[model samples]
Target chain A: MGDVEETVADVGEFALIRRITGGRPKGAATLLGPGDDAAVLAAPDGRVVACTDVLVEGVHFRFDWSPPTQVGSKAAAVNLADIAAMGATPTGLLVGLACPSTTPASVVDELSAGLAAEAARARVGVVGGDMARSDTFVISVTALGSLDGRAPVTRSGAMPGDVVAVAGKLGWSAAGLAVLGRGFRSPVTVVGAHRVPAPPYAAGPSAALAGATSMIDVSDGLLADLAHIAEASTVAIDLVGGLIPVDQRLIEVASALGADARHWVLTGGEDHALAATFPSASSVPPEFRVIGSVTRGAGVTIDGKAYTGDPGWQHWR
Target chain B: MGDVEETVADVGEFALIRRITGGRPKGAATLLGPGDDAAVLAAPDGRVVACTDVLVEGVHFRFDWSPPTQVGSKAAAVNLADIAAMGATPTGLLVGLACPSTTPASVVDELSAGLAAEAARARVGVVGGDMARSDTFVISVTALGSLDGRAPVTRSGAMPGDVVAVAGKLGWSAAGLAVLGRGFRSPVTVVGAHRVPAPPYAAGPSAALAGATSMIDVSDGLLADLAHIAEASTVAIDLVGGLIPVDQRLIEVASALGADARHWVLTGGEDHALAATFPSASSVPPEFRVIGSVTRGAGVTIDGKAYTGDPGWQHWR
Candidate 1:
């Protein structure tokens, strides 16, 4: 923090907002940006995909474990992943931040920078937001996306005999969390994955274009998220244990910590990897790897048999 | 507060969300409602107006003074007013809620009901939301609106010689606040105004259709919000002291509280009243009462003289 950095109370709400949004660049979809009563976003296809996610201090993140920038990035990533899971191209974002009055203004600035950077990577912009005083930090992000005239790929469209595939890394975030829990700072990649997930932003729209039957993001553990799909599509899914790709680093970290790598791969959440069902294995793009198949039953199984284990993440459990 | 009412922890996150959003009616603009990765909203005009606002416990509201339903209504009111201020037709809303695990599930249901009522009043619906556990209650609402092919009425469009007018009640909320501060429980209307504002939702689009030059909602005091228009438009506003409408009920409440009614009328906020400028007095709609006029200077004046007093509500001040 800089010596000259002031607390949020020292700078009034309007001034603080002005400072945060003042010279920020906007994307093509941003017809009108902040400073106005409301932002105007172009929805050329006559439809917009919208989603919101909230992160509370100590629950979703901790300042001691993750930097302000990483917190902001993770917040953006989670919401953007929802849009991606809908097979839409993210257009813009609106953020609502509540924090203590004693918080330094520099922290907010870093968070804003992080949000902008992640939004840019996803080809979107931070167009509007709200800020308020709170006893603890709370970040709520709403992502707006466009389908570009394509039909949305919902989780209910999967059919029997369809191939199940995934894009982006699996279980990295869960592995990273375990690593962090053990106080191991080395293996920067694993530790960083826990702090800020890198979801495959382009795979969603690509899968939609390639005629994916159903899609979802891996926020909860794979089995838990797949259970949602199975319930929604009224189809059972069978995962091939051998086909599940396990990262070498995750294996190393799990072995060192005496943890089962397969548990993390099967039940890890927050990786934001894109999971989809395709009509055939050949229809799955190179970015996605076939790991399972849709069957005509209920729930999920491993190698055509029920393998009982811990389900994915659930809040307030 | 029933014995059978389960805590949020007992119901769990996913079940809580499903119970909140299940089988609710959707508006015409809601192409796809919740229970998916994202919600789809139709913005047939090819553009969407969006804004967000957050209300935190003990900071924006008090549980002792407000029930969960009132809290939800007020949260929805503020964000809907922002969309109305932009001269757009509000079509949908996305809410993000955070509360303690010990909170009863019935409280959330009541809050959701309140939100639904307010959204219905504004001709919109709650399409999606995120809920999480927090130590304090927090509600973040994002309102989405459509212009319907009309140009947005920005705050910087006011020109000299335009007539300034307002369409909703002023100072009633301030008087109500004073009454609340003085610990008075009677005067149901005033107390109700403070808890749930009745913004002039139709007047914004009406004024836009009537060729209003500039517009804003009275979230801050009349003079303070007008100052914003003045600064943005590079013009001054002069109010006619005798022409300003003062509600008799507000005057009575202020007299009982031994507070200056004029101060509240000019500087009190959270009224959510639509104030705009027209090219001429003849062009002003019947719903609006002319209170002032635009002039070629900076700042605001009353009866051609600058009346200095408290500027208005400033968060974190």
Candidate 2:
């Protein structure tokens, strides 16, 4: 007989839970982990930061483009970045996954491994989860965080004169998506960036400590997310085109594809870079670079003019 | 034009979010609510209790049988029950909702209303949530709770000499399901039980305060879930059949349907009743009634014999 591949139906529900959670390493904050009805985690700051993000199969991702492992890690990364944007340290993640029973057990295994790997990187645990059957595959992850006694830097805190800086890679995922859309995956770096995002998790709390006025996770394009801060804080922002750094790698890929690199840098989404407003340029951390300043007008602008590029990947639009 | 029915797409993602969360009441623990990247909730006890539960459109509930509001409340009830099972009081909830773009905005609004009504009853809030578009409708709720300095009562704490008891309704949801399956809806009580469970939220912490050894939320029938506690605690339990209470309403419905009410009482799921083990009968709280005794064996027994009835509605099977 050829190697017999097992599906989730073959193993049943409780056994699958045991397989997913058994022998998984625990994080520092996991007072109680899976196998019980609920999990307990240390909050430390007398408060907890929480957020949720959902990924659907055909809409949010495709198996042909990315493996199940990358999908799982992407799920964890996206939700954890929300905690970071709140200027908090994540403690654990709870995943609610629904998929067809006909799906191979290997897919679920690899996906769980990916989630574990990302949680490990963030020094947190996949503390709890639920599994169900559905025609459409959906993974919902909720991230819980501890603020470590630092006040949350909200989007409404930005002042007119505050400096806008960003920490981590920008437009990498968008460029990678462009490459994949063109049916080319030769550039491993760009392709891999699309499959997985490395959000700057630590810079959030560091920026909070350095007197950040406002912050956001750039998952809906840099300019669009900045517009969110502007609307919430009732202030305007202006960015110098020269000050906005477009990486050489992205520029090369854009040139090959006959696309505008500057547009991608300004309006691309899903890189999960951290954007924050500092009181002054001196207060900006080394991880972040000043790209603009909050101004006394209405919305985000390029130097003085409105950026008229395509608003790429606003998410759910 | 006949008043155009608004779909989620017509309302757009941001507008739908505002309609779902705007002006909704805040809970006692809600330090920060929706519209932020993440919500902040008071942990109070230096630690937080958490759990997640996912409900799919066809797999978990049907719109024809239960209204959208009930589905929403059911989602909240199930996740909040998990927190109560941990001997903690829930502080707030984070929801991740995925549905088709064509879904009615009114359906979304009523569902949000259901979630809010239940949260208000539990003295918590729908603190934050995410909205996404998909072919199937899925609701994933994460409940966070505080222990109030009480030690968590895990399933493994049942001892051989402990007294077993239960709080809240049993077999009501199952009877309701059976009633609905037979094409009858007169018994609104039973049908409503299936749609929204009134899980004894306060009884859990009370059980822990009464020095209860172990506890669980019974969403998988009495025997099946008791088997979990038995396996986790490495001990058997024997229930006195005379002590088991089958509601008069259930008996009335079962008699008319020519079904066995006892079997329903034994193996019915989704009533979300709380079960616990105490050192003695006197230690059991007023909310609970003594039904069995823990023994030095491995599984659950009904009047010292193995129950051979049908195991109804095991989730994800």
Candidate 3:
């Protein structure tokens, strides 16, 4: 194994655990960190918000497109965004990693670093985790959050006449993905956006505090996820095409790649933007921009009609 | 596609999620169940104990050896046992499942049923989960527990002169694994033990209430797990060989298989029994039987000496 780059098996499970968790700083929400049977976290409001998300290699990410650290960040970001979507701030995270025994130890180290990077960005830590041997690389993350006495903003809470708004970038990830898929990787900002989403975690709780009627994370595309809220709330949502914020940078990249930036903003997923409904325009938070409104109908639409695009182009589904 | 059973891909991701969570009975601890971005569970003590465990198809369990349900149960049981080891009662569970797109939908259904069965056994619920397409089948379960204001029993609190005790059966799973390895599955008792572990969840808090200093769930085998306690507590442990309780049924199984029952008891993995150290023998709870004593030295020993058996037979490591 000399200088040949030791694999996970070479380092052993316990040793690998040490490498993954050692010296990582835990936040105040963490009562007891790693090296115990279980990690104890502060659930200040007497309730814990939990959700799990799994990312499979090749299916969810490609190593050539995103390094281990970015992939790790994406995994943690996805689950942490879920917590935020529930109008809660994340307290801690638990990761379950399974990779082939021959996987380079460096990959695990870099991935752990990436997870810690994102956890730190969210003001938390990887409180606990487990690693195992598998034929494929799979990362499963569980994020826990505290509501701080706020009622969860579920998908079913929006009502007719509520204004729909969003916080965070919309189609940057999709634009970046398109650029990467075309075998060109310039405009590092867009590519970076695709690899690591910067979810507006604070906007969630702020929206809840501002009397948000409903909230969701944009994981399965804007229209698709909006449709979820529409179905759940038994209402219809119609987005103003002009109001959908298409970042200028994305437009430039889209033009260079010969793609429609607006379509990406409408149907591309993985941006992890927070989308919520407010009872009135005045109730909307500063970070959120008004984009649509809810009505007494079913399904999501563009303006007053259904917008049809390439169905097979639904990359996330 | 006619006359063909549906695969998970055929039902789609969101539909499969509904199949996995719909109609499931949520426990009292589950304040909000599935169909949301995250789940909210009651953490009555204002603190939550969490841990994660990953089970890979060929690495942790073989479908040929155990059905999907048992494998699912095993996955949940391992994480729940970790929570219990901390003197906490599990409140809710989140599962992250990844399997091939071609995998049968029925397998996912039965596996979810098995997870629900075990979660029900623990009086908890599978509050939320995520499913994805992967090249390998993987089940990652995270268990959240409530301490109910009790101090968490950790592995680093044992002091010199403490009495060592254990609750629940040992070596049974090992014997069962042995029987299965021989391709002889007649003895349903042993074989089943290998498939599903019955962790003594209540004994953890009972031990803590009885002033037990340290505790750990026996996962890596008796001696190996005790070593974790010894190293963490900075103390030595010596087990009385004669005092070790090898179940008579296990003895019969081992005898019929020409294997040493005591060795299995001493070194078996995955039984999920609770091993604890109390201030004195009198403080040991009714469910626990004293087996040894703590001392002022380092490392774990058997009958005041290091016991060495066949090396490379470590099935778990």
On residues A22-141, what C-alpha lDDT tens digit does candidate 2 reach at each position?
A: 567889999999989999999997899999999999877788999999998999999899899989999999988888888888988888899888998899999998888888889999
* Model 3, span B1-317: residue lDDT tens: 78899889888888887777667779879999999999999999899999999999987798999999999899889989998899889998999999988899999999999998999988999999899988899999999999999999999999999999999879888898999899988589889998999999888888888998999999888898999999999999999999999989988988898999988898888899999999999999999999999999898898999879642222225
TM-score, per-candidate, Cα-based:
0.98, 0.98, 0.98
* Pairs in clash, predicted candidate 1: none
| Backbone clashes (count) for model 1 | 0
Q: DockQ of each candidate's interface versus the true one? A: 0.88, 0.79, 0.70
Candidates 2 and 3: which is better by DockQ?
A: 2
How far residue B116's Cα lies from its native spot in candidate 1, in Å, is 0.6
Off by over 4 Å in 3: A311-317, B310-317
lDDT (tens digit, per residue) of candidate 1 on A1-317: 56666998898788777765556669789998888888999999999999999999998888888888988899999999999999999999899999999999888888888888888888788988888999879999999999999999999999999999999989888988888888777589988988899999899999999899999999988888888999999999999989999998889989999998888888999889989999999999888999999999899999988767788888788
DockQ of 2: 0.79
Q: Give the per-residue lDDT of model 2 (tens digit) for B1-317.
A: 37978889888887777766667789999998989889999999889999999999988889899999999999999888888888899999888889999898999999989988888888999988888888889999999999999999899999999999999999998899999999888699999999899999999999999999999999889888899999999999999999999999999999999998888888888889999999999999999999999999999998899998876465556
lDDT of 2 at A150: 92
Per-residue CA lDDT of model 3 for A79-165, tens digit only, reads: 999999999999999999999898999999999999999999999989888888888999999999999999999999999999999
Off by over 4 Å in 2: A1-4
> What is the DockQ ranking, best to worst?
1, 2, 3
